[model samples]
Target: MKFIHAADLHLDSPFLGLTGLPSSLLATVRQSTFTAATKVFDQALAQQVDFVLLAGDLFDRAEQSVAAQAYLFQQFDRLDQAQIPVIVSFGNHDYLADQHQTVAYPKNVTVLGSQVTTKTLTLADGETVAISGFSYPQRWVASDPLPDFPVHAATDWHIGMLHGAVATGSDDHYAPFTVDELLSKRYDYWALGHIHHRQTLNQQPPILYAGNTQGRAINETGAKGAYLVTSDHGHLQPQFFSTATIEWATATLDAANLTTLTALGTRLTDWLASQPAAQPTLTALTVTHLQLDATDLTSLRQGEWLNLYLRTHARQLKAAHRYLVSVTPQVQPQALTAPQLDQQYWDQGAAAVFTPANLQATFGKLAQEPALADWFTQATQDATLRPQAEQVLAELMGKEDPDVS
Candidate 1:
């Protein structure tokens, strides 16, 4: 028996943290989710898989995107025409709701409900498979759903579909279950979702997360796709296939002895020329071993230099089919030298100033605005805030030696 397991399609979800993108590139970004999903269906048809399992989050219910809805209808029809069965289980983003339930998917598609239910399929080879899963009733399902899931069914193969996370001991919004608990069910396979990084929890029974179909942000780097599982020697084996048309990557460029913005631009162009992706790539560039004067460093720190470089080097970027999302400086603390003030004192000052409370207070009324509030929440996260603070300190220290530039 063969089937494809995929999740987190996130169809028509807006590309996050993108700005100043060329209109053509923006259009591609907008359609990327759909494009990635189409590839999954195309593969399903080509492989002639008996069934396809979409673990969850087919689309963002909050967005209520018309295009996403229409695209699914069209694709499901395509699968129906090919006589391929599709099993869908909606996750947190597109949970089971009365409004969505009003419109039914095509006859070929079986959408799992809020309660744990089992669907049995008979493969062409006379193999019987039982699939058990459930969709989220609301935004969160606090309770462990394992108790509701029945023991392995009396079938040739039993596969479990789940869109959730591992137990964290506290309040877990998603359906949280431990690996041991899942193994206790004695299912042949577990097609998991929710987390956007594809990974296998168990090898024997093939428990795994298929990850998101496409990369929407820089953090979701590398090849994003789904799994094609085939029964091999009484064991279910899964293989990953790429579906993402636009890939997100982070690369560190060594800027040692490179001084001017023009030199950096040339280096970046050369780097793009050397490392080419099959699909259009969006890169988050980090410059290490960088040495720049006060003004240049300030420009890099403020993203002014990177923006200017991008604007000036449009031809090179287009030729390489690459876009620089951001350029971050990865300089050491010792590199940010201030003749007047000690590094320890500067660090102490930063420690006092860059706290969450301080940042929230500084943001003041901006927090009241929804869009700004969301940005503020992410921007104020420790990972983001620490780098920004370091950049600011570097800029300030660079200013100490104004004549050096």
Candidate 2:
């Protein structure tokens, strides 16, 4: 039976990590979801797949943009053209019951409800493929979805499909299921989702989460995409397919002892050049222990020539590949003391802002007068602005600053 398995197509992403990129450029990055999904559709059509199984997280959130819906329709339309059947379960991100307007699945699509539901498919060999699943319904599911595993048709094979957090004994606030319960049913294939990383939990019965269709952020790192499951009458062998067109590269140039912007730029450029030709998109970042003495990211954004060069470079490396050159300051291990280890964040800002070099290099330039410098220093004193000042200092230090409130 030919079937395509995929999940977590977070389309029209807000792109929180991506910075300095013009709103237009950001829009383009978000648009890559369509391209990625289109590739999956193309893969399915090429395989002449009889059905498509979406384990979960079909969209980023319940409040997904219309563009996401539109793009999904375009893909489901392609599947519909192939006379393919789409069986889906709602993941934590986008559960159908939570949304105001139900997503319009293609005529051939079958979305399982909040409770256990099943659809029986009659294959050409007269064998039946029974698919059962459920939706998240809310942000958290307290019960184990495995115990609710629908009874299968006693025909050829029964596939238990679900979107949940799987664990034997744990209070994890996601979809939690048990291996013992799953084994008891003995389904031919167990299609799973929710976890971004891919792993083959069971070999005896092929069970898998296709993983997020695309990596939305740096944290969802490494290869992201779907799994292709091939099963005959006896056994099933699942192969992971990397369908993501965008990827994150945590490129670090150790500046612990060495210095100079040209050297840093060279290190970054060399790393970018080292990227394989087949890599569609990459975010190259540099981590410096000592704050670098060079034109900062602000300068790169303001200087017309530098800005033009960076954009041209991103465009030059294939229209799809985006090489984001971001820099972050690295702190030495064992540098932070015990009291500082967990100083409630407020204290860290007090320390970082009062650092000799930072006070001079950053605040010393303020207004040329001691009082103004004192005032600039005092503005960071307020508990309210301490967090903001810390973030500003992060920007100054070339650290991947957390999102400003």
Candidate 3:
């Protein structure tokens, strides 16, 4: 039997914090989610798969996007016409709620309830398949869901669908479950979601995450798409297919050869001309070993120089099918020193100051604010925070004492 497994459609996701981009690029970004999703349905129809499994996060209900709702209904109806079934389990972002129940999808679509239940399907060839999963009752489950799931059913194939993360033993707000727990169920395949990067957790029974159909942020880079799984012998094999209309990437440019901004511009243009992309690619570029003067380097890092370059070389950017999302100097770690102190002293100081407890204490009451608190929580977990901080400190100290470094 053959089927499609996909998750995290994130339909109508407002690609937030992208106001700096041009209107034309912004329009493409806005439509990218829908475009990516359409490709999944198109693939389903073309491949003539028995059914499609949408593990979770089809859309964010908070956006209140009518377009997203309409689009799903239209796509489901199309699938219905082609006699293809779709199984859906809502994730945190699109948790099971009253609004979802009120507006039912096409008859062919089977949306799992809030409680763990098994949906059995009989394929055209008279083979029985069992899919087991649950939708989030609310935004956060905060509990282990493994206890609710039963052992593999007495069918030709048993697939376990889960939309959560691995139990980290702490701070697991989603439906947490362990790989060993899932393996105990003895299911033929495990389809996972929640995490946006596609990965295989097990090779034997074929447990994997389909990832998001489209990347919504800069951190989610590379080809985003679903998996086409086919039963081979006694195992299910999954093949990845790209669906993202646009891609995100981080690249570094060596600038040790050029000393002037004029030369830099020409070099950047030539680089863009050489590396043409198949589709629109949003790039976060870092210039390393830059030979420019302090003022020119500051201008480049601060966006003053890059802004002029982008405006002047709009045609070049379009030709290369790339957009410079941000340009920053590569922060090379340096031994921060003082007239009387050594690198060891600086390291010791940083170790004491950058501790999570100390950072939280420093944040103090500002942590009461949810937005800032979340940012602080992530910041505290950043492994490179101390090194980056040291680099910044060294740069500041160099202005005061040239002999310090």
Q: Which candidate is the best by lDDT?
A: 3
Clashing pairs in 3: none
Per-residue lDDT over 1-405 for candidate 2, one digit per residue giving the tens place of the 0 to 100 score? 767778777666566655556565566667766666677788888888768888877776568777778777778888888788888788766766666544676798887888888888887667678887887787667677676776556757688877766664644545677776777887888888876677777778877777777776665667877766777667766777777776765656566554555555555556556654456455655465655444553443344434554655554444535556455555433322223246557566567675546645765455343223323433234554545555556555444344542
- For residues 162-212, write the lDDT of model 1, one tens digit per residue: 999888875466798999989999999999988888998999888999999
Ranking by lDDT: 3, 1, 2
For candidate 3, lDDT tens digit of each residue in 178-240?
999999999999999887899989998888988899987777899999999999998899999
Model 2 residue 17 distance off true place after TM-score fit, in angstroms: 4.0
Window of ten residues with lowest summed lDDT in model 3 = 370-379
The C-alpha stretches of model 3 lying farther than 4 A from their native spots are 97-102, 336-381, 397-405
lDDT of candidates 1 onward, in order:
0.85, 0.66, 0.85
Top TM-score: which candidate number? 3
Q: Every model's Cα RMSD, please? A: 4.8, 10.9, 3.6
Order the candidates by TM-score, highest first — what do you get?
3, 1, 2
- Against the true structure, candidate 2 reaches a TM-score of 0.73
Which is the winner by lDDT between candidate 2 and candidate 3?
Answer: 3
